[model samples]
Target: MPSADLLLTDTHIRTLDPAQPEVTALAVAGGRIVAVGDTDDLVRDWQGPGTERIDLAGAHVLPGLVDSHSHPVWGLEMATGVDLSGVVDLDGLRGALRTADRLGGWVVGWGLDHNAFEGRPIHRELIEDVLGGAPAFLRLYDGHSALVSGAALDAARITGPRSFDQRAEVVCDGEGRPTGYLVEHAAMDLVYEVAPRASDQDRRAGLVELLSTMAATGLTGAHVMDGSGLDLLAAVEEGADLPLRLTVSPWCMPGVDRAGLDELVALQKLGGRRWRVGGVKFFMDGTVEGGTAWLEHADCHGQGTDAFWPDPAAYSEAVRHLHAAGVRTATHAIGDAAVRHALDTIEALGESGRGAHRIEHIESVPDDTIPRFAALGVAASMQPPHTAYTKGDHSDEWSKRLGDARAARAWRTRDLRDAGAVLALGSDWPIAHYDARKVLAMARVPEGAAGPAQGLTGLEALEGVTSHAAIAAGQAAEGGRIAVGLRADLTVLGLDPVTAPADEVAEAPVVLTVTDGRITHRGA
Candidate 1:
């Protein structure tokens, strides 16, 4: 037997493997777990003069966390721009825009919520007043809508009201003049076309920084639910070694032709082990707060819109096409109607061993739809911290949009688990904090706070960010478990998460993180 490259000892390792649930030590070689067992035995057998040994000092180790769905590039890009997440009113909005104005360039901001405006509609005039006629574009927290100043509208050549096949609309005033608000991607693209894009250098730096930040939080892998896989490839091409593994999903929107599908399929084969395109992503409905989620009926009598696709049948056909091509499909479905439609589409494709078709943010679903997730083999990728954005008393914008009865069903993690669905958890970073501890904390106390009886057990919550998340990323066989042959990706914690109190688990510190046998982060 060859000597191992690295050896970790004096640790309580929770392997997540039923065969060898617990071990005292593990040996890594060639970026994979070569052996795991009694610390003394492995040390004596595997250690060599060239091997490096680390003492964990009785820390608890588990498989490194995997964020099943996140927007790494988007988050990093937003970090460089003004963050409007703190804006609570029109004054705050103006203040943020004013701050951005001082920074110069095309003033870009994100995380604005209309609910914070106290029922006042966001007008171009309001933004123009702050920018002093400078072009500025701000996106809502939901990412489904945007507010652009008159200067930006002129730059984008957006004049009167325009129609889009994908249910996107440019809001118009009573006189049919364009409002600053734009709904859905089609509408938002007009602004993006005119807006200055981040330089390749900036994009590469952002990706590297974001991945490093993720590693510090004990994340060894992430399912990047964004459209910028090329940026990651560019970073790698520039000789930047990513800190963690990434399974990228290209954003696939409605009206995509066969050529567009081919482009995505080509992107899938671009990267090596550190990053790869795992699947295609779609948005079925917008969001509850945006009044774009396809609910059973209109919440608050708003007449919630139709699916994002111009033709519902065409959307199904697209899923079927991808499923047939051996590619996984992940659809963002936050409302009951959208959830049903996503499930129905996946079910229509029949069974296959290709990939795990999933629904991101199954925030609201009918009771019957829960069981179908398991029956249909659809992975439920959800973020628990998203609930923290809501008020516990159901007075939050999202809750009010959902009403009383449906509001109680927000993020039904336990119900989905009880119904035998595969629940994969994530942070959806930029929208919420990316720390795994906070996510676990929210998951532990979801009852009454996030949703009625939606809380999950400590072990279940752990699995959501570990094993289940790996499965959702289509790496079930190679990672997720701390078996002898699995990848050497591990997270060393201060205590045994499964045995500790939920609150304690949330506070537990991450002592170290290892990805592919390389120590990415270490804390004293």
Candidate 2:
């Protein structure tokens, strides 16, 4: 009716809507699905001169894929400089640094793995010679820490340990000299502040390019985990349309008082047509590899007993404040201790916080913590590809740190699903590759790096990125299903995601992508 804006025909639609599980055609008008039924019947009735119709030629179409955890806008800056993701050992790391290009007279590289050190502590002395006296900053793969060359430590004027509002540390030697290892956001910010940064124009352009690249991989929406690029998002929309819809959650770190809470609450009003500040992100713990994962017991390195928040009660108070304001929250909880504390905080909120809170990166948890997710209505937001950072034989840094028992429980995707929890999946880009297909593939099949962790079924994995994703975002009523009156966000693939082999699904051809009733990407 009213001249459909878009009509897709000759396709097998996997409408997650229970009422109509399958349909051949769907019509869209004003950014919402207008109708769905037999191709001939719907097209004959809804098609008009103004309608833009496309024949999918039997491709399989599903609800537009959503990355539950991503940092597309912020990642442009985080992922800049030379990529060290492929470097495997300290020698390789040194070689990469020797050949790394400079940015504003400083050598910068990201995605450096801790295993490259081969059990050696992360110290500038390891790579200072390779830098040849130039200031160098390298981001550890976890994104929670950084290793700077001695020159960089001097450049940032970071002479010794300092206090931070959060659980950050400027790692130092026994002699009281800076070791060039910065732990957590605060310590890393010291160097990053003085480091050269891209101009506002370059950052905006990079965001557009990065998001467009994600669209080519079949992403129609993303639950951006940080709120750094709100102004850039608004600026981009002012000039042109954003390739995907983004639900941003600004961070609420430790030491926040009433005034800071008020500032975060007011940020909820900032948004553009395709992006909105819907929730607040919090970090309950740093990363396992960084020796700060808040584990119940000490790691092999005797670290991880501390939470990211200097005062655990302060974090609980902040969550309570946000929950009272009808705000949803997601906390980074990678270790069992951190996960337990986060759940305990929500449990104290009673029925109101049941489904309003979520736990991100439940990397290793006890058996008891599994069922509480469904019981408390807490969504389990996990990144499957993160397992790639480990090794099956317990040789990688993450596995060795946790020992045998804890590492065995790594990324319990299937267990959480079976326990009736809302399991939302993503690639935590900048931490892992952002390809949505890999998220599905890794979820369905636990490769060697996953270390005996159970994987999800095809249908279950599909729901992780679709239905469960929407439930996690509290948008279950409008998105995640192909039905009349739902948002016209859809992804067309060369094969059915639910029936295809995991490997095949990983490389499935993205035939087309539609966001908000407009085609964003189409393959030849």
Candidate 3:
């Protein structure tokens, strides 16, 4: 047998494999686990002159963590310029804009929370005075909308109101003048068209830095929700390997025709050693705070009754078309109506669609929607850290918008798991902090944001990012466990995550990280 390329010994390994639940040592060859046994025996048998062995000194090692949902490549654009996530009110917002950095002559910023507006209608006039007449574009934390200055509106040639293929709106006043509050992607893109963008060189560097940071936090892989930077990713992979694995999913928007669908199908064949374009992303509705969530009933403001798609039937037809071609899909459905519609669409695919589809951000849903996930074999890809956006007392924009009844059901991670759903957890990144540890911690003890919602057990929380994450990406056989013959990806920590306190788990020292037989991060 060939000598192992790498060997990890003196570690407590939790394989998550029933056959080999625990082991003292493991060997890697050709980026795959070669063997697992007693530390001394495996060392004597597999270690050769070329083998690199590490003694973890009693550290706990588990399958490398995978963030089931992230947008590292595209988040470069979304998280650009200054960060306004900490600002509390309109005054704080003005203060942030006044001190914000400019990108290509524009006062660009992101993470502007809807709560910062203080129930006031958004308009350019609020921050225009602070921007010094520079064209400014500020992204709301939800990523579904933006608030641009009048200078930006002029730059994009947006006058008054316009029509969109999606349910986006220019958000005008009594006089039909755009209020600078652009709701949804289509409307926001008007200013984005002329907004300053990072150069490909800057973007490539930023992505490398971002992924490396994620690796340091113990992330070995991510399910990238956007495919915009495929060319950039391909270039990076060719020049050098990515620090983590990425599964890219391009979007299938509302206006796609048959030719567009064929284009997406052909794209599934594109891949490199560590990255691949595999799935499609669709938006069933916008966000609850933005008044775009497709609720079963109207929100308090009477504005959450519509879907993002102008015609919901087109979305189903697109899914059917993709399903027949054997391509899996992940749809962004944040409201009860949107979740139900997406599930209904997948249900229409019969048994074949089961397990082949995922619904992202199942933020709020009724009791009936919980069981359908397991019964239909659909995966619930949720972000536990997103709960931080709401308040436990139901005073936040999201809770107030949904009223008490629906808002109380926020992020039912535990309920869905109890009902036998394939639950996959992630940090939406730019939307929330991308720390995998925080994700584990939040899933187990939701702190104060979840409003008395039951948290997952420590073991179940770990599975969300490990085993269940792989199932969400349809890579259960190729990865997820620490068994022999599986991919050589592992995360070594100072303590056992499953048994550690939630607070400790969030701040646990990451001792080491391995991806594809290569050490990506080593902590002091």
Q: Estimate each model's TM-score.
A: 0.95, 0.99, 0.99
Stretch of 10 with least lDDT, candidate 2 = 445-454
What's the C-alpha lDDT at position 46 in model 3? 95
Lowest lDDT block of 10, candidate 3: 445-454
Tens digits of lDDT, candidate 1, 1-524: 78999999988998889999999999999999999999899999999999999888769899988888888876665554688888888888878788774334678888886666666665777768768778888888877788888888899898988877687889889998888888887898888777877776777776777788788878898888877656556556468567888888888887889988888777777677588788989888887876788888888748565777768788888888777777887999988989998888887777773246999998877788888988988899999988877777887788877888888777889898998888999988877778887777678677433664788888888899888888887888989889988999899989887778878877788899999899988976
Q: For candidate 2, lDDT tens digit of each residue in 153-237?
A: 8988988889999999999999889999999999999999999999999988888898888998999999999998888999999
What lDDT, from 0 to 1, does candidate 2 have? 0.92
- For each of the candidates, the C-alpha root-mean-square deviation to the true structure, in angstroms, is 2.0, 0.9, 1.0
Off by over 4 Å in 1: 101-104, 353-355, 447-449
